[model samples]
Target: MTTILLVDSHDDARRTLATALGKLRSDWTIAQADSGLAAMSQMDDKSATGHVDVIITESQLVDMEGVTLLDQVRSSAQQPLRFTLSSNSEAEAVLANSRANQRFLLKPVSAEQLANIIERSMRLQHALNEERLNLYMSTVNAVPSVPAIYDEMMKELASAHSSLIKVASITESDTGLTVTVLKIVNSAFYGLSNRVESVGQAVTLLGVHLIKNITLTTKVFARFKGSKLSARRLTQLNDEAMRIGALANQFARLAKLSRSTTDHCQIAGMMANVGELIATSKAESDDGQPSLSIEIIGARLLDSWLMPYAVVEAVALQHESPPRNVDMLSPLVVLHSIRYLQKTFTDTTDDQQRTLCHEYLAQLVPPAVAEDWMDAFHAIEQLTAAKPPRAA
Candidate 1:
């Protein structure tokens, strides 16, 4: 049985949410508190039965901010999944503390939307063994925290008067990130005629959305730079990630997906191989495989870093066979197709894998269209290969 704590200063609002939640999940025990202090008291009360599995709180509590309550709960031995209901005025503050395990719900949330969020979070939680993941992370001794610069850049981008200069400024704050951005923008993959010297120029050329993804990709790889993984292996992995990200971006545009979804696709593609990085670093020898699957490890890492649920989902399902009857193209579908094609075309020995890829393609498009997609894939591969190699 799950226990959910509902905290809101307004008596009516708390009761309303609790009633709706109880109706939605009869088995879940609903607890309520009028203020932050009251909520902490209830959690601290040893006599209280049933550990809280989730907490949904108002942005503004009578005694303190919802973020404060979240921070305290996170510091405790039991870190339950957290949700905050905030209006536009409070979103910045609420988002500042957001994590993969925490969710933000806009005010006036519908019962159905709330239920869906809870169910999704619960499903993700159940997908991996927390103790094992934590143990592996600790053993690696290089667990990455959410990048603060990425958060700041997101806040800037979300502003009504978002400025490219401001985004450049954020990028410039990190010397390593600025260098990475410039190197990538000047790389043959982009095919720029002139050299780009500054972050501002790179931002102007690449736009904020693309720059944001580049920054995230750089930060993620930077975390494991000095780990057990060999430099050659790491470089190969980074190159492959860059190729996948570029392909994902092109596919998203070809499919005419929304700007937000396109960004998600690119980032998800770049991050899909992160699990392999961890596995490679943790293995006793270069030839050994990881104890855990790369997809699960990558998903867990991204989830912890507060990446969008869609991005996390795409990375998590990268290795799985494509779902049947997918009429619409999505980041997951695109990533799966890319991975499948890479395997099918590059490794002709794997007849079973090739057959599976063929069957999956047939479900998505006609044979002719599928053939065209393969051609497009080769074009992308050729373009990616033309890029200048990273310095040793």
Candidate 2:
């Protein structure tokens, strides 16, 4: 039975979480502490028989702030997993150290989501203690410049019909990219039994859309290999964002909303965080990054790059309610909310959100088509996971 400490001034939250967790796992123990001091004292319980596996703390506590208490926990405890529970929709820009493997969970989190976080965090802890994985983060954080191959690929993707042959032709022209892509696809990442020997096979395995992103992002990761911050957090954020973006695009396509713009659905999802991801990488090299901090920097990047204003607005206001603009194209808010549901799974406001989804889905699509939209996202996820890597 894993023991978890819940410290927060909010009685409702404490009780609510405790009840839900207990319902989820009968043997699990949830010890309540109103303040950080009480939490530290409880941690010091000499007679405390069960191990406190993780601490679910709040950022704003009466005795001490969340991060301050976490600093102390790091100093005294045996690196117990610490999670900061808050209503702040924004994620913590800085992930917990690889050793603690802890994370932040917004309030109204579901039992399933909470359980998943706990399991992953503990596994990370075990791996750290056993020294099975290494810790590395970029020290001098410079967001690597986009690779030329990727830029050209995107330009072409945005141009005339770009078939597999066109992609191969583009790669064939660049000797450096041709070799590099072939090397990556063959690397352990893809797990191809027969190593990819050419750029064509790599592209074929990755598919055009995915290869486009890989060509764009791989160099970004490779450049920061020896840096202070590990690329894990950025990659995780991007991958998750991509999945949601793809889903959003799929939803839009089903609604028959933005077909004229080409894979406008996909474009909406892909560029939703273009500004944020790029800017986050750049800003971290300076001060410690914070969520909701770099939205403008990202927005500016997109604006400068001549992206559609609708896409920019949609990506910019990801954490807030949908903007009530007159244009129907401003579906960013709605699309973002759908993606947000993954993290915002608490039942407290689920009814409202669900109604909103239903109403919004009805507006863009018939009931049957909207149902198909949801089904498609799940199928895409499964296919993406199972599909063999794209060949060059």
Cα RMSD for candidates in order: 6.0, 18.9
The model with the greatest TM-score is 1
lDDT, residue 369, model 1: 52
lDDT, candidate 2, 1-392, per-residue tens = 67878889888888888888878877778788889888888888835625688887887789776767776886775556667777754323222211121345555667666765566446434533332111112232453454677667665654445467687778778676566567545644334689777666766775565455445444544454455444666555545545555566556656665232223345456555554554455455565554333443444444334343344455555565542322243345445645554444324234675555556655544666655654564465464566423322
Candidate 2 TM-score versus the reference = 0.44
Model 2 lDDT, residue 140, Cα: 20
Candidate 1 lDDT by residue in tens digits, 316-380:
88867655634445677778878888877664345675566666676766655555566566676
Task: State in Å the error of residue 39, model 1.
Answer: 3.4
The positional error of residue 195 in candidate 2, measured at the CA in angstroms, is 14
The ten-residue window of minimal lDDT in model 2 covers 131-140
Give TM per candidate: 0.67, 0.44
* Poorest lDDT segment (10 consecutive residues) of candidate 1: 92-101
| Candidate 2 backbone overlaps, count | 26
